[model samples]
Target chain A: MDDSQLKRRFAEWEQEYSKRPARACETLSGVSLKPVYTPLDLPDADYLRDLGLPGQYPFTRGIHPDMYRGRLWTMRQFAGFGSARDTNARYKFLLGHGETGLSVAFDFPTLYGRDSDDARARGEVGKCGVAISSLDDMATLFEGIPLDKVSTSMTINGPAAVIWAFYIAAAELQGVKPEVLRGTIQNDILKEYIAQKSWLFPPEPSMRVITDIMRFASEQVPRWNTISISGYHIREAGSTAAQELAFTLKDGLTYVEAGIAAGLDVDGFAPRLSYFFNSHLDFFEEVAKFRAARRIWAREMRETFKAKDPRSWLLRFHTQTAGCSLTAQQPENNIARTGFQALAAVLGGTQSLHTNSMDETWALPTEKAVLIALRTQQLIAEETGAASVADPLGGSWYVEALTDELERQAREYFRKIDALGGMVRAIEHGFPQREIADASYRHQRAVEEGRRTVVGVNRYQLEGEKLEIPLLRIDPEVEKSQCERLSELRRRRDGARVEQVLTDLREACAGTDNVMPLVLDAARARATLGEICQAMKDVFGEYVEPPMF
Target chain B: MAKRLRILVAKPGLDGHDRGAKIVARGLRDAGFEVIYTGLHQTPEMIAEAALQEDVDAVGLSILSGAHMTLFPDVVRLLGEKGAGDILVFGGGIIPDEDKQTLEGLGVGRLFGPGTEIREIVEYLRDRFSDRVAEETGD
Candidate 1:
């Protein structure tokens, strides 16, 4: 139990494990794992100052003291596919399955601001997620679900402002006030440049649009989270855990600076600013990454912005299990992988969690697959007793050491980004892209060289294994039906009103006027996604990526 | 003198997800292949015109929109009408095994799924291109 005895036991255990040579013990970030850790490893650590009580300074433990005891983290299953009617049915199905919240995944057309009837959207009307080209589709997508009661998160960028305006206008149609609407827009365009590559305008105008939303949301949508600055897609694009943390926080800093420059007080909008992260297979590293994120964010918000509100300093985030980690070979093993990942998110004090389905390596998750995925989170929350205590590994020597090391690495990245004139410059200069490429290359090398063992990929050689899991197949007819719906929508809406609203939207974009209200007006007029986006494009112009990436 | 093998890498449909297409474009370029990527949300017509204007030896269509069953065959059929069917046609995405087989049967040169090593695709194209040239020259 004492330090010397623990160290002696660790030495003997390491020697034994080294002799076996079968199971390699290491962090997913390539950090070596020792058999045991002691106080000597973390000497200058102040528990209260560094890893304080929940809701205290630095707030590494948690943002809330009674994290899940009062109310469990929302089991928000990200669901949407096909026409609005189909996605609406899926939403009700998920809600019936005990899902706590709704997360919308729009199809490519909606994400890229193309109407279902557009030539560019021909075969992709409702393929990946739901297709919402007009207010009619938005109204149908949330038909039975009450906008005021249930929280919704829309996974959209590029056309995030227009999509969010549609949601707000739809909420108003349902008699819900903007101040009472609660959810997230994922309006972080900066991350789209870093990893997702779904950007619309150039960086300067994009940040301007983002800041305008931040300011408008602060004034109107008090309960809504304006921007969920995401590191999830970045990590999914093959970034290491530290890169996910550092790059995501750098994005947060960029948004903060933009918001401050827009003449808003930091404390006014900072509390509603949330984060979305990837919970990969590396349990300890993931936990440490989350803790370090909170510590770094709290310190920056307080020291840099001189914020007086404690609420403004907290970094509340939602965690989703990494979709890229699922293996198509021996897909059942993904269940265990997701279980452990869910455990990590819970232990990391995620405010909400979504465990990816096992069959996602193939297609959109099926009903059976998503139910099991939801059960994975439920099992950890109810059976594992992890939710009993906040920050269960707060005092562990290994966790503390890992957290400190991760913070150091992340701050080094922060310093590098700062020297390169922040995240936008760094992205344009291909710094983050090159870093991610190098990390992805290192991971691929490890898997090939047997330095890291993927369960069924390299070490576990099960050749010609047949997957027993049922794959989800989208009906080809869904596209045809969605196309028909778009045709009917175009036929029904008043053409003159739509044209006038789009003209106003274009003129608003051409001036100093905020585009959010104009976008909302366009949504209300049932202007198609392509029409609205083209209006803005005529003013802001489309982005041409520099010869960097 | 060896002529450059120009290829138009297009991401047709509304799929804003371009990680795979971007990576493959980069990989092909690094493998000494000239690649002109007509960014996301390109129509099949736009892609065909671009391929014609670029005078590409091949056109690689990348669509993850689950629309490849209809989209891939359209591209091949359009290329045929435009008298460009001799250009090698290939595609990649989350296509089902059965669908890939169907696409291949319908004259698609190759169908790549996830976890495909970049080298394998590059080598296949190299050998196939030379074989086609040899047949044409009666060598």
Candidate 2:
């Protein structure tokens, strides 16, 4: 039918649907939805310019032309708890079970640039994630794992450079060169201040550290992704999907600007800048968010930044299912929730994926729970033919409309961020933080008012429910042993050389020098992660968050 | 009218997951409670000090770093040592059920886990303080 006839039919359907009691029609991000979409929705959409084929300019469809038909996504379960030895064993287990990549989760002290021996680190050492305090711990963590063969992604923020140097030095001990080492460091400090709140220094020094890593990696560790600009933590901090998309992209643009300002060429450093997104509950909205992310990044890189290299335009990302969507009640239900969210990510064309375990809300996943989460991804990749083609739902009217709508919403956000002088200043002003807080509050109210139905929470009543899932508990002895090892290393390592390298690092932080080499030197000199971070913190100073609700 | 229940919401340790803490604080504020939030990275001493300084009747400690075993009990102990034992101490995070009971035994009021409604917390606080509120107003 033509546009007029299609409009008339849609109106008639709306009238009939309105006669019955219709629930609130909107995505989880509060984007309004229609009962059905038609050809009229794509009235002005030009397929050639807007969405060329996959691997072409403006990668709205997918990054790779063949997508999963050529290769399956890298399957990584983000596992780390207790000591490095504890996590190394888990990594071997995952690899033996056909896992493709490795991702490390660090403890709070390690993430915040504090030592295991610091007073603030007490009771928190090796509690939430693996405690890697020194080069010895990094070497132990990767002892059996081959550095050259496997890819690693470390989910660290404030002390990314120190941890990354440790990894490189550990690889050197393995006789592996930095040139062949492959992986990503979650070095996005903007997200730290805005959402994750693991920031070490003020925004100025953080951006400088990020650019230094980018320039160094582009030269030496050519295969390594220096920064995985993340929106996962932003979403976990309770921002809506559109907010997640907008704020994350805006952050990416700001990084590009910083790199350029630091006297680095855009195309040289931009290709190594990867992205990380959260696969939220809203299925089509999430899929749309991913597509829109690629499209926006491509346009901004090619048109705005004038990046000549096509590699710089592709928005390669790793996706994790939303952690906030998991329920502590009827924990088994989370397995299903994760499965659907993972499917949404794959359908949206993720390069890598991590499926959250069922018992995460209670504690870190037990071996059994983590294995089930892995198998959920395995089933999606093998049992389902969802990845048989590139962008399987590419031509769907509803999905395309959603994709365009998300792009429009994100561009509006871009304009807003630009007006605020960029993401760094916006974060300093607590703009994104306030936005996330407001969104989270609205979401909580929706659940309480019965507008949002979380199964086994507000909707289903399971009387006298008991949590039967086993939880992984970090041994308190782990903390005692880790601290002991740290003290022993302090006694054993070349204390004089460590102090000299740290002083050099401190000077580099004060000056306009690329601090990565000094960081690597400090790593080789057996300087602890805390010492190096403190050396810089001594100069750059720490960020004190102004209280806001 | 009787004074609104004063409660202090705190983030103890390096756990930066404040989505719940902020929401709970805002929810308590909306429910007619005067709420004070310690933004992030607070020690047990700082939290206890803030509770005393704010003169809050109750303190809510939010942690997700699995240090609840160490930090939760420490907060209670510090409050007691500070002669603020009458101040109610509760928490929310990934605390296991057994640990939750142990914490309650150590004098923490009603530890809410994930998926807890703000209304449940508001109601619990109202019920716990209703008698004191009555005593305040001579009801």
Candidate 3:
């Protein structure tokens, strides 16, 4: 049966189907869903052009041919809270529980480039994540964990370069070579201005800092992924899957262009660039988004950027189950939600995954909840047969159609972004922010109007459900100990050496020299995170966001 | 004529999570209130100064970083020091059930936890402010 015969059969089926009353249906992104999908739905989709063989160009099926069969996706849980020592214990615990990689979540002060003792950092020290103030803290945080053995992903931006320098210096203390360092820095700052709102400097200077890391890492730490261009935060902030994909890829393109402008070879740095995406509850939609992301990145890298290496074209990403979808009511239900979402990520061929713990909506996850979250991934890998085949849902009529539709929508967004002169300009004009706000508001209204049903939120209401899950509470003593440690370090460190290195860092920031070396020196000299950031702040100044809806 | 209700939405301390705060701010604005949003990394002093300068009738502190124990009371105290003691202070974000009672006992108005409806917050403000106006006018 060729195209015409399939089309005739589809028309006959639709005629009969249309006679019956249709039920209202749509995806999470408001894309209208059909009662059924057929091959005729994707008549123009060329198999060879649109989705080539896995491990080939335009890798929509999967990046590697064998995908999970060759090696399972890393069970990298995002863990960090309280002081460095406390988080190190958590890291060792996760590793002992069969976790493969480490993903660090920094506290608010660390994320914003403030020391634990900064007045603004009071009460927030080690609250959301580990507070790493200097090389001393970084060394202790990774204490016994060999940098050469475990691949680490640090989720920090704005001050990513500085934090990364601390990591490099700490690795030096461990006698690990820079070239052996394998991990990612969630160093994508464009997403900061667009969604996460953790930005430190203005866009122009931030881009410069990112490009400098690209240049330095390409030479020194070839195995390290300098930037994890992220859509996880965008989706968490309420954008649809298509918006997250297009905006994130557009940000990647912006970084690629910046690298080229800074005189780096496309293939040299592009291969080390990675992505981070959110795996939400809409399983098929999330899978489709991942497939479309690969196709877009592959084509853009090979054609648009004229990259020669196949590694440069691969769209490797780390996925985390959606945190926003978790509910504070009937919290146990979130375990099922995270399991299904993690399965979607596995089927979508994520290189790494972080399953959200069930109790996250109220507080950080307790030991039991985080273990359940990690076990969710382990079940999908070990028990479920989903990982046996690459792109298990590939070639399904509904999935292929959804994948094509998502790519079409993302391409339309790319055109609009290009017309607006690119992502930075679009963000400055409040394009992505307004888009997310509108989508979020629409979804909220739907939930309120009973048009959509979240399992325990608006529908299937449980009256006066008692909270029973154990919640992780960071001790206020964590803050006190951290501040005391920071103060003691200040008193014991060579103050004059810190000042001299900081002046050098300030000079490096003032000029065109790559600031990584100077920052590494500052870290080595025991210059605190805040002191090094202050040097850059003195030169670059702080960014104040303009008002937007 | 009744004065238009002005509210200041502030995120105190070092938390960068602002999705809830932004959503509440927009919700209040859509409900016809003038909202001044103090962006991320705001200290208690900054929040209190913003509330005093904006002359808001209410100040809503959105903190998700579990620092509500320290930050919320500090903001309330600063508001008093700035002679804005009459300004209604409420809070939201990840505050536990036990802590909610403690915060309210410390003169913080009703604290909304996760899964709270924006309309409920809007309604709470409407009732509280109208009661204040009636009592002051000796209705």
Give the C-alpha interface root-mean-square deviation per candidate: 2.6, 0.6, 1.5
lDDT of each: 0.85, 0.93, 0.90
Candidate 1 lDDT tens digits, A393-491: 888899989999889999999999989988899988889988986677667657646687787866585878766877777777887887788788788
What is each candidate's fraction of native interface contacts (fnat)? 0.42, 0.89, 0.54
DockQ of each: 0.44, 0.91, 0.64
Native RMSD of candidate 2 (Å): 1.1
Q: Residues A1-549, candidate 2: write the lDDT tens digits.
A: 578888888888878989987765899999999878888889998998888898887988899988998999999999999999999999999999989999999999999998888899989998889998888999999998989999999999899999999999999999999999999999999999999999899999898999999999989999999889999999999998889999998989999999999889998999999999999999999998999899999999999999999999999999999999999999999999999999999999999999999999999898889999999999999999998988888888999999999989888877887789888888878889999999999999999999999999998969999988777888999989988998999899889898899999999999988999999999998888889999999999999999788
Q: In candidate 3, what are the lDDT values of residues A40-135, reduced to their tens digit? A: 777787889988888888999999988888999999999999989999999999999999999999998899999998888888888888999989
Which candidate comes out best when scored by lDDT?
Answer: 2
- Candidate 2 at residue A438, lDDT? 99
CA shift of A123, model 3, Å: 0.9
Per-residue C-alpha lDDT of model 3 across residues B1-139, encoded as one tens digit per residue = 4556899998888776778888889888988888998877788998889888888999999988889999989999999998889998997998777888899999999988767778889999989898665665673
Clashing pairs for model 3 are: none
